[model samples]
Target: MTDTTHNEYTLTCRFSSFDTTVDVIFNNTVDTINDCQKKNYEGFISKQDYLVPEILQQVFEYYKKSYPDYYQGWSYGNQLTKQQIEENLPTPTNAMNLKKFIEPLSVYIADNKNCEEGTFGIYFDCTWDIKSSLGVVIKKWKVAEVGTGDIAFLF
Candidate 1:
């Protein structure tokens, strides 16, 4: 029922040695001015790849300090300060490192099955090593949520 422009992004982190990878799927929707109603199956207006590292860092801080259950996946609803947002401004290097810009179409179509929906934060099921799993989530960011896990495994 929200009109907010739909935004979606996936943050994937990988650890080759452990054979583990984690992805954070973020989707946010709110009301918008346009009357043309469109349904957004996912959340987020767009995936901002440059912020991946910092966002993952934020998640790490949350998990460490809060000791979240992470059963169904923890939910975090915090607004980014103007300063914080500015600091996360996307750049060519960050996006390239994440491989988001390299394969835009593939990244956009990947399924969200690994991602668990949270109040505002995106969560993933961690059946493997917790520390290793979290390590993957800490790396990589994309400007949009469109892409697959192929690039993550490359790291």
Candidate 2:
């Protein structure tokens, strides 16, 4: 059980075997605390509510459906440091083109079918290297993680 109180609202999460129950209390009278609680307790995860990219959310759902035992919770937390991002950036000479840059990678999990309990972590790494017509080179890299419906992007 975890309780968090803020000026705008108060949130309490109760963990259980069936599902997690989240209750919310609003400081303002106009807020519907019960409605908020209902929204939070729903079993399904929503990308719009969490501001997650649809592609990332799809990946999460895929893992959840394919490997229920391995999928614990979805998370969007920063697990990589700036230095790591810089190190993972692609070299200018091997950069991918624009069309290739936005293309999503095929989702890969260490254990596709057999997932253990606790927390399941998914890592995504992307690098873009662009070479201008003049031979100038630019490098970019991004690393992301998904766990328990949470997603984090490291650039």
Give the lDDT of residue 18 in candidate 2.
Answer: 15
Output the number of the TM-score-best candidate. 1
Of candidate 2, the 10-residue stretch with the lowest lDDT total is 132-141
CA-RMSD of model 2: 18.8
- Number of the top candidate by lDDT? 1
Query: RMSD to native for every prediction?
Result: 16.9, 18.8
TM-scores for the candidates: 0.23, 0.19
Model 2 misplacement above 4 A: 1-7, 14-32, 43-155
lDDT of 1 at 42: 26
Tens digits of per-residue lDDT, candidate 2, 58-119, equal 43343334333221111125465545543533122322222122222111111212222111
For residues 27-123, could you state the per-residue lDDT of candidate 1 as single tens digits?
A: 3313231111111112322333334454444434434443334321222353655344323222223322322211111112222333322112223
